[model samples]
Target: MRPFTYEVPSSIQEATSRGGADAAFIAGGTTIVDLMKLEVMNPSRLVDVNPLPMLGIQMREDGLRIGALEKMSDVAEHPEVVANYPVISEALLQSASAQIRNMASIGGNLLQRTRCGYFRDVFTPCNKREPGTGCSAIDGENRMHAILGTSSSCIATHPSDLAVALVALDASIYIQNGAEERVMNLDDFYLVPGETPDHENQLRPGELITAVRVPRLLWARRSTYLKIRDRESYEFALTSAALALDLNGDTIRDVRIAVGGVGTKPWNLPEVRQALAGKPLKPETFAAAAKLAVNGANPLRHNGFKVDLVQRTIVRALMNLGGLA
Candidate 1:
């Protein structure tokens, strides 16, 4: 590890301006600390923001608002989240291990970096790690690489299961630049690995994420998150699906779907959602619409299995949620 300055900021304003541009904000230090040790990410300074009072979960009339610093375990176990946003709770519980879930902050998890071997190994050349350097995962070992929203510069899969669920809810993020506050749809927060694969989000320097809001979607109570991995525990998903359905009698009223472990970001299937809406909630209905989830997927050499895996995962999630499985 490199020698660095450490500062504890009691206020969000202090935290944001505590260190240089290379300074990193630390809440639980679950992701930042590990990457620093591996030399995958090394900041000149570490600014601790745990004491900034970014806490509490609120059930507002508009939505369920979650503090950015809230632990994954706490959010998952919160009765409001569990009762109203079942898929969000399920996704959090299925993420990492119990110990990690207890310590990892919700904000940190949303910003979790790719787990691609080439991206993590500093010795290897990766576009995500260092721009202009070619992505090794593209031609090298890429079984865990992305299939959807991939570019020539990168094919790394997003590793956040919670993000997948949030995507399905069409959540919004509340951000702060000192006192100035703004909110944006969570879907727009993440950027694709277009020409510049290094830039992942829209967070400007010193901007801090304050909270996340999930709008009041009554039908999300009938939602579920399904993940398929090589093993199960303490593993990243090979294919994960998050679905929220609104069924009117035997017909689908509205639906929201997002898939993880197969995309550069949490992949939302608007086409699939559109196809399933108003259609009868049947086995064949789900199986057919699920196929649209892979409309423009560009699978690489080793990760071609994801093309089929994601579809099956989506079908299973929808089936289980609709009690057809």
Candidate 2:
């Protein structure tokens, strides 16, 4: 590992001021530390923001506002979160392990890096790590690569179950740079890997994420997060679905759906949501809606199964949430 200077800022102003091109704001250090050890990320300075007094979980009238430094375990165990937003709590609980969940923060979870093998291996060519270097996953060992929002330049999938649930729930992110603050919808948080795969998120340099705000929805109480991986626990997803539906009697009043492990980013399936809206919650309807989920999917050589797996996962998720599965 490369030698680096570490700074623990007591204030957000100091943290923002200290962050630059060669510096990164560290919270939890679950993802950043691994990359640093692998020589994939060589930041000259690590700005620790855990001491900035920004760690807490608050329930507001609008919805829930989770602090950037709040641990995943805390958020998962929060009574309000577990009861009101079971999808969010379940997603967090299903990720990593107990030790990692206890150590990883919500902000750091949102900023977790892709699980692409080539990117993790510093010796291999990975466009996400270094632009114009090419993507090895494109034609080499791409079983876990993305099927949706994939481009010729890259095929890496975003590896965050929490982010997927947040996207389905219409979450917002709060970013602060010095005294200036900005908020953006979680749907716009991630960018597709096009010509420039190195740029992953919409966050600007020195901008620190203060909190994540999830809007209250009627279906939040009846939502579910279904992840299917190679193993039962402590593994990355093969295909996952985060679904929330508002059912009026037997008909769907509203629907929000986001998919993970099969897309370049947390994918919101508006087409599927639209198809299910105003329709009866039935197996056939779910099958039809699931079909829409994989529309325009361009699967890679080794990841063709994801196209079908994602559809089935979506169907199962909808059925489970509707008490039909």
Candidate 3:
């Protein structure tokens, strides 16, 4: 790891003043330390944000506002979260392990790096790490590459179950930079890996995530996160679905769907939601909606099976949500 200066600011303004292009906020240091050890990330300074007072989960009239410094385990185990938002709890429980969940912060989870093998190896060309350097996964092993929202410049998948669940819940992020505060929809927070794959988020220099707000939903209580991986536990998803359904006498009143593990971002299926709106929750209806989920999938050579697998996963998720399986 490179030698770097460390700073702990007492206030957000002080932190922003200390942060720069070469500085990064250290929350849990799980993901950051790993990347630093791999030489994928080299920062000249580390700003410890844990000392700040922005570290609480509160239930507001509008929704649940989770502080960026809140630990993953605390958020997952919060009574309001587990009782009202099962998808969020399940997504957190299924990610990493108990130890990691204990140490990883909600903000760090949102900013975690991709699990792409090529991106981890500094010697390999990764467009996400080094712009215009070429993507090694394009011609190399790409079984876990993205099928949706993939550009020629990059095919790396976003590897955050919590982010996928949050997207499905239509969450928003609150950002602060020296008293200038702004809110952004979670869907728009992450950028597509087009020409500038190195730029993953919409956050600017010296900006810090303050909190994430998830609006209250009637269907949120009935939601679930279904993850399918090669192994059962402590593994990334091959294809996963975070779904919430509002049912009115077996008819789908409203549906929220976000897919993970097969897309460059948390793939929200608006078309599928449109197809299922006001439709009866039946097997055939789910099958048809599932078919529409992967409508424009651009699978790579080794990941063509993901197209079919994702469709099946969506169908199964729908079935599970409707209790029709």
lDDT (C-alpha, whole model) for all candidates:
0.91, 0.91, 0.91
Which stretches of candidate 2 lie above 4 Å from their native place? Answer: none
TM-score of 1: 0.98
Alpha carbon deviation, residue 83, candidate 1 (Å): 0.4
For model 3, residues 259-312, the per-residue Cα lDDT tens digits are 999988888888988999999989888888888888778898988898988888
Model 3: lowest-lDDT 10 consecutive positions: 51-60
Clashes of each: 0, 0, 0
- Give the lDDT of residue 241 in candidate 2: 93
lDDT of 1 at 220: 88
Residue 191 C-alpha lDDT in model 3: 90
Off-target runs (Cα >4 Å) in candidate 3 are none
Model 2, 56-89: lDDT tens digits are: 7888889999999999999999998988898999
Clashes of 2: 0
Model 1, 6: alpha-carbon shift in Å? 0.6
Query: What TM-score, to 2 decimals, does candidate 3 have?
Result: 0.98
